[model samples]
Target: MSLAHPAHTPDMINIMIVGDSISHGSSGDWTWRYRFWKHLREHGSNIDLVGPKDTLDNIRTAEVGDDDATYADPEFDPDHDAQWGRPYLTEKDEIEAKVREHEPDYLLVLLGINDLFWYGVEPPQFEANLREFVACARRANPGLTIVLGTVLPCRKAVDDPDFGARVDACNNRLRAVAEDLDTPSSPLAVAETAAEFIATEHTWDGTHPNPNGELRIAAAFADALADRFGIGARYPRPYPDVPPVALDAKASID
Candidate 1:
C-alpha cells in the first residue's frame, strides 16, 4: 500500500526500536539497542531514538518492569517500544499508532521468538501476522525503512525437536517475509543474526543475549544498515576492546 509518511527534516532522523524482551532487556543488560545507539553516535549521525517506554524489567523478580533504566552504561537514549512477553499477533495496531505518532524514519524490528517459544505459532501463520504488522507500519508511514531480526537458536532448541523445527521454519519464513513485503519507499532487510550469532555462547539464558551476543546482534543490524540502507559506518569489531598494536617502521610503511 502507498501510504503517506509524516513530514520531517533531513537534518534529524528519528528511529524507534520495537520488539519483545530481547530488545526490552532487563536490569544489568547492555542491550543491542544501546550498542547500535553507540555505533550511530560514534559515526556522528543526527538521530533521535524515540519510543514510549524506557524502563528495564527485572525478569528474575516477580515485578516485571521497575521503571529503572539499569543498563550497564546508562548514557544513551533509552526510549523503546519493546515490552517483555508481548505477543506478535497484537503488535500491529500498537505499532501502526506509534508509527503515526512518532513518525520515525526507520523501524528496527526484532520479534516473534517469544511467539514461537510460548505460543508455538507455525511459520505460515507467523509470516501472516508479520506481513500484517509491516502493512500496518507502512500504512502509517510509507517512508519508514524496516529491518527484521531472525530467530536465534536457543538452548531449548538443542534438546526439543519441535521447538528447533519451529525456530528454523520461522526464520526461513522471516526472510521470505522481508522479500515479499519490501517496497521501494519502505525497503525491508533482515539482520544477519542467525548466521553470525552463536546463541549458546552469546546468550545468558537460552533465549536472551548476553554481552557478547548483544554486540553480535548489534553488528548484524549495523552491517545491514550500512550495506542495505547506507546509514552508518560498519560495526568495527565484535568486542568493544581493541588491542593496541606497536608496528615496526618497515611494517607500518608497507
Candidate 2:
C-alpha cells in the first residue's frame, strides 16, 4: 500500500519528484525537493504532496547491509542498481516501472546530465526518452500531473568550448518537449530552469552542484511548482540568481 498523507481532497495539491543527482540532494544537504515539501506543509493552506520517499542515494555502492541497510525509502532501494549511468535510458524501463509502481499524483522528473555524459545522446534520443517517460506516466495514471525540469546547465559543459552548443541543443529539445507535453490532455508543466536558476560559480565540478547550488536548483524548481500548482506566495527564495541570457551557446554534441 502507498504511504498515508495528511487530510486533503482529491483536488488538493499533490506532488512527486523523480530524477537523478539533483533530486537526490547529492550536495550534502536537503535539496529543494524537500524544501518544496516543507514549504507546502508550512505555507499552502490545503495542498498535500505525497509519493516516493526521499530521492537521495547516499551510498554510491550497492552493498546490501544489515536490517538498517534496507532501503526503507521507496524512492530508492539498497538493492536497486544502475545498469548504465548518464543519459540513463539504458535503464529507463526500470526507472519508469518503479515510478509507475509508486503512482504519484504529480510526477517531477530531473535527469539527462548522466545521459549526456555517458552516451552523449543527441537531441533526437533525448526527445525520445522524454516522450517515452511522459507517455508511460500518463498511461499508468491518466489524471497524473506531469512536470519536467529543463535539463539544467553545467559549467563543465563549457570546458570543451563545444560543450555549450550541445547543452543548448539538449535544452532546446527539453523546451520543445515541455511545450508538447503541456497540453489539455496531460496538464504538463515545464519548470523552466535556464532563465531562472544556474550559478556557474556555485557548481561543484562544473556539473554537480554544491550545497548552495543545489538550493538554487531547488528554488527554481519550487517556483515553477508553486506557479503551476497555484500554491500561495513565493516559496522560500527560489535559487536567487537568474541564468544569464548570454550563457555561451557553443558546445557541440560529441
Candidate 3:
C-alpha cells in the first residue's frame, strides 16, 4: 500500500534513470544511479531496475571485475537510459521509446548542464523541452511517477556568471514545469539538488559526480520519493563536504 497519500505505488517498483554524462559515469566511476539503487535495495523491496542500456560510458566488458576498477560496486544492476553528451533535446526524442519498453513505475531525471554548455537552450526552451519530456513519458505510461532534479550548479558557475545565471533561471523554470505537469495519476516531485549540491567538492572535475556527490544526489531523489509518494524509505545519510564547514575563525590567530 502507498504510505501517506495512498497513490498507485507498484509492489514491484520498476525504475529508470534518464540523464546525461554525470549520471552515465565514465569508465571507472561509481555513478549516482549505483548509489540510488543501493539505497533502494537496502531500504525498499520488490525493486526491479529497468532500462535498455547498462554499463558506464566507454567502459569495457572486461573491466567489470578488476580490483582497481574504482566503481564503488560494479556489480549493482546498471540498467539506465543515460548517455554522455546527450542534452534534453536529444532525450526528448528518445524518452518515450525507452519508457514504453521498460514500463518503469518511476523515472529519475538529471539533465540541463549539457544543454546549457552545448545546446544553447535558454531557460524558456529548457522548460519547454522538460515539459515535452514529461508529456512523452506519460504518453508511454500514464501512471509513471517522476522526480526531476533541479539544475545543479557546477564549476561553470564560478567561471562564468552568465552561465551561472542561466543555470539559476533554468532551475526556476523547472520548478514551474514540475508544478504544472504533476498529477495524482502521474505524481511528480522536484528534488532539491541545486541548493545543496556543491560542484567543486562533490565532483571530480567540477561536473561529474565523485563518491560523495553520488551519495548526495541519491539521497535527494530517494528522500523525495519516500517523502512525496511513499515509494522507498528515506535515505538519511549525510552528505560529505556539504554545508562546507569552516574552521574556527580565531584558531589560526590563536
User: How far is 206's C-alpha from truth in model 2 (Å)?
Assistant: 2.8
| Of candidates 2 and 1, the better by TM-score | 1
Write the number of the candidate with greater TM-score, choosing between 1 and 3. Answer: 1
TM-score for each of the candidates: 0.87, 0.73, 0.84
Candidate 3: minimum summed lDDT over ten consecutive residues — where? 245-254
Tens-digit lDDT track of model 3 for 177-240: 8898889899888988776679987876788777778778888888898889777687775554
lDDT of 1 by residue, 86-158 (tens): 7678897689999988778889888887788778789898989888999999999888899998887788877
Assess candidate 3 and give its TM-score to the true structure. Answer: 0.84
lDDT scores in order: 0.79, 0.57, 0.77
RMSD of each: 10.0, 8.5, 8.8
Each candidate's clash count: 0, 11, 0
Off by over 4 Å in 3: 1-10, 59-70, 240-254
Candidate 1 at 11: error in angstroms? 2.0
Write out the backbone clash pairs for model 3: none
Best-to-worst ranking by TM-score: 1, 3, 2
